[model samples]
Target chain A: MKRVEFFVAVLILAVCAGALWLSRPVAAAEPPNTPRAASDSNDGALFTAFVPVLRHPRCMNCHSKGDYPRQGDDSHRHTMDIRRGPAGFGVTAAKCSTCHQDHNLGNVHLPPGAPAWHLPSPSMPMIWEGLTDAQLCQSLKDPKQNQGRNLDQLVEHLTEDKLVAWGWNPGPGRTPVPIPHDEFSAKVKVWQAAGAPCPSR
Target chain B: MIGFSVNGKRVDLDVDPSTPLLWVIREQLSLTGTKYGCGMAQCGACTVHINGEAVRSCVAPVSRAEGKSITTIEGLSPDLSHPLQRAWLEEDVPQCGYCQSGQLMSAAVLLREKPAPTDEDIDEAMTGNICRCGTYPRIRRAIHRAAEMVAKGGAR
Candidate 1:
């Protein structure tokens, strides 16, 4: 009877240990992308490092706060005097793809083009301008605001979206995001591994 | 070989598929009424109709436009008598006249959608087109007058 009791106690301890192991940092995490539900990791610093990239004109120009998008490094109001029409693209007459072709043209100062170039659709504006780091982080994690994406989807988008990739190579005469593409993506992953924490501010 | 219908006429052209339709319309076909303002989609100056919807042809690729029916300012009327055109003249809606073609093209779509467009509808429809002269009030009046003409029988 004592032997059976001892065995049962051993089983309970083994189960507890297994659970604790599953709960540790991602270094031991299987499947690689496992994000902790919560942690004390320097999530604030990771996210703060990403803030400037978000604020960069290549990213922020499309994520405008107002109905119309801002333009250039100076963030001047779009000289075309256009607005975000029924869709984020311009109205019936001047759709976004009209000038922004699938790829950039040779004219350095002319329009910057990319595949399917246009602002976020009206349904998912994803406006990042004027958002506090905490709000921005929360917005990214929130499925409603982040195009119904969970953490995995967000990571995938940051890593692979063609339009987002435009930041690294923003055509001629455009200052791109400061961070290298791989580094930026790596930073995002590190932040995710840090349990995707947010800044208090 | 690329083929598209312009103003109800089938046009066949030998050109790079990636070339912009605006250049085709202006340079190759020699239909120059559609003006290029910013050469970006922001200005409605290059606005034209594609399958009854307004589209800026400035950056629209010739390949994507293949097999689609295109309408330009020239297609609006042979006689310069489309109701919107007549109303534009009646309201004196131009100052420098660079953006007038795009304005008329955009306004045509609005009148079709909302025959009796209110100020709000006008604002929404015509917002894409810009006149450096700041002739918005006149454009609004022209749209109203054009709507009235359409309701009467077909804007003449």
Candidate 2:
């Protein structure tokens, strides 16, 4: 009976040690790229870093809900009465490509341009103009609203998509997104690493 | 060399792809009918047809025209007999005559898309072309007259 009790105690000690080892930081056990689960204390703050980027004129000009895109720092209606057309580009003679080119023109007040310059298609406007930070975060995470992007894709788009990158180098005279591109990209990665948490409000 | 057909003639040029198609058509191809009004494309004076679609050439890169067919005002008709041109003459549409080529080019596509364009269609289609001479009323009248000519098949 004494020997059996001793074996049972040893077994319990072994199990407790295993539990302690498993409770340590997951970084030691997982692959380098595996995203950590959301840390309750940090996720909210991580999402806050993205708010200014989402609201910048450079990002909102094309992401608003409307048949026409706004232009300039003033967010005025585009001159020449341009329409969003069947595609996001303007209709007929007033198409986006009619004026915009693959890159910015050398002069200020000239048409600021980039490749495939257009608004989100009418079917999927992805409007961000009036959304609260919480709502925007939820919308971004929702696959239906986010064009079916998973967290990895969301990170990739925020970090590397050319159109999104345009918010950084938006021509002469245009104010770029408030955050530096690399900083914004790092925040996005960190947020993704924290399971892409959203603010409560 | 970048190759494309302009007004039914195939030509190749060793120009930078970023050069505006307007300069290519004007300086290299020597097809000056497509006038340059606003180099920013705010005005439609540089309108031309790329693969039958009306395009503003002033802002369009030569790279965008690669392997495409370009139609200038000169190609509207070999003998200035396109319906829009005929209507413009009949209705007396030119004032300064500088904006007429671009206006005609834009109108041709409008008519092609809307065989019998209504007043609203005309307003929508021709809105991009600007005429500082205030010939809008006459331009509208000419588009209507051209639509009628098209309906009757009286002129090609």
Candidate 3:
């Protein structure tokens, strides 16, 4: 009976060791020219950096739940009765690009622009109206939801994408994003280098 | 300087405080209903009640509202059960609703001052509130409907 009890104790010890090993956090592999840190790869810090940009009025207005984009910081419905078209452009004759140009036209109070001025396609609306930070980070990491982009592609999108860069240069009468685009891109790089882990909701 | 009761809270502030009171209310106090449209005050999108009179908020400096009772849309009724709101719902006077808050505020003042306002009275009072959707006819109708509702003691 004593021998049997000793064997059971040994078995439990081995199981505990295995569980601890498996539960240990894994570090993300760093890319070329990227800084390496164990905590940087963790999902929480990365998500914290990403949330502010997502919540900005410029980002939230077009990515709203309703068909119409809101105006001003107040998030009121669009004044001109504009509706998102079937293609996520404007309605029949009023394509968004008509007023929203390939680039910002320097109008202080009008729609600030980028080459891709319209909302995300209806097929992939990428709704950002009221998403929590965790949900947004998780959604962004998922290729199926992120317009088929992997972590590396997402990094490139943030660093090099024209629309993403617009936050820093949003025309007059608008509050520019709190963080500089270059710093934001560096944060994205750190996150991707850290295995693109999403925080647990 | 001006002293006024805003949203039932009395306060005093300097006039020409950089931006308009619409921006001040939205950016400072976070009361965002009064929109900024045609900042030159031609659009009437920033109407607020000043001592039972409809005044354009975009152009009405803090000095002008001093020592007066100023009310915004949020103060119309805590639950939006104001007569103008009921009339608006009955008539569906909003298309985009960006301009409705100002419109409702203006109509509320008109009804209070001229309980039995005519088309002419409404036109004269409502001239400042501009509806970009061209819902003028509907707005006119709702104001009259609200007047009738008030007469029957059904409006609050």
Candidate 4:
């Protein structure tokens, strides 16, 4: 009876240990080419940090799939008959930069702008319309689909990309992303350096 | 502040009380189709049905619409399959489309009250809705088509 009880206790301890191990967060692997600047082991932490910015109105509106982009925090379709063109700039007659200047126009009911005031190119849309974080992470890593960018290129894109920086300064009447652009860029670098491992959905 | 039935659901909102019902409906309730154009109410971009009457929402205050049944574009139909919507699509009466929501809301009230509104009646009822797309002819045709559809029992 004493030996049986001891075995039962050992089995319970083993099960608890296994459960704890499974519950612990898995660290992301570092990519071979990941820049020294972006090295970090916390893949899950990186995704959690980016959730709000990825889902912000400013980012989601232009990253929409349909021809017409959404507007405002409500995510309604654009008022005008705006269409994304073959080049994804905008309709031929009404290019995106026509109303959206190099910087935000500071108008209440006009097109907001950024230095590169255009949609993602059709060839490599980098579509984020309805992507889950895991899907987005996987999609971002594909060089062919993500504008032929490697992990290093992606790090550079996030850190120095003009449009990505716009989330911090989305103009009047727009809500900015939760994190500062510099902080977000730093996180991206960290995630890339950690091997750009996708968090389990 | 006002109390009204929206899409058959009762709602009460506290606002400027004298502020235009349009602002209350949009800013407070987050129903955005009812637009703001020429806040003086000269343009019917903010048209909505108040107690079955087509009222210009931009000028009508919350106090005025109090205890009334107010219906905005979102309340028209869940999927936008209203007869007016079908007719508008058939006639393609949209350019910038900034004004179509108001136009449709106004037409909805008109059609509900007068199932077979005459051209003269339509002109009198719809004169307020200004289409910047120069779709006046198309608007007239769609209204008539909607009426015909209603007459044929095809309206949902």
User: In order, what DockQ does each candidate have?
Assistant: 0.27, 0.36, 0.02, 0.02
Can you tell me which runs of candidate 4 are displaced by over 4 Å? Answer: A1-43, B1-156
For candidate 1, write residues A80-142 as lDDT tens digits: 555666667765444565456667766666677777677776788889888988999899889
Candidate 4, residues A52-94, lDDT tens digits: the string is: 7777887888787776667888888765545565677654223
Higher-ranked by DockQ: 1 or 4: 1
CAPRI-style quality class for the chain A–B interface of candidate 2: acceptable
Task: Go through the candidates in order and give each one's C-alpha lDDT.
Answer: 0.81, 0.83, 0.71, 0.72
True contacts kept of each: 0.39, 0.35, 0.00, 0.00
* Top candidate (TM-score): 2
RMSD of each: 8.0, 7.1, 17.8, 17.7
Q: What TM-score goes with each of the models?
A: 0.77, 0.82, 0.47, 0.48
Candidate 2 chain B TM?
A: 0.98
For model 3, how does the per-residue alpha-carbon lDDT over B1-156 read when each residue is reduced to its tens digit? 556688999776654643455766777667888888776445667777667666556654455455778788888988978878888999988999988888887788668767888886677566656787999999999999989998999977
Q: List TM-scores of chain B, every candidate.
A: 0.96, 0.98, 0.88, 0.92
- What is the C-alpha lDDT profile of model 2 across B61-152, one tens digit per residue? 89888999999999999998999999999999899999989999889888887888888778767778899999999999999999999899
Candidate 4 clashes between residue pairs 3 or more apart in a chain or in different chains: A30-A194, A31-A195, A38-A189, A38-A193, A39-A193, B1-B17
Better candidate number, 2 or 4, judged by DockQ: 2
Full ranking by TM-score: 2, 1, 4, 3
Best by lDDT: 2
lDDT of 2 at B60: 84
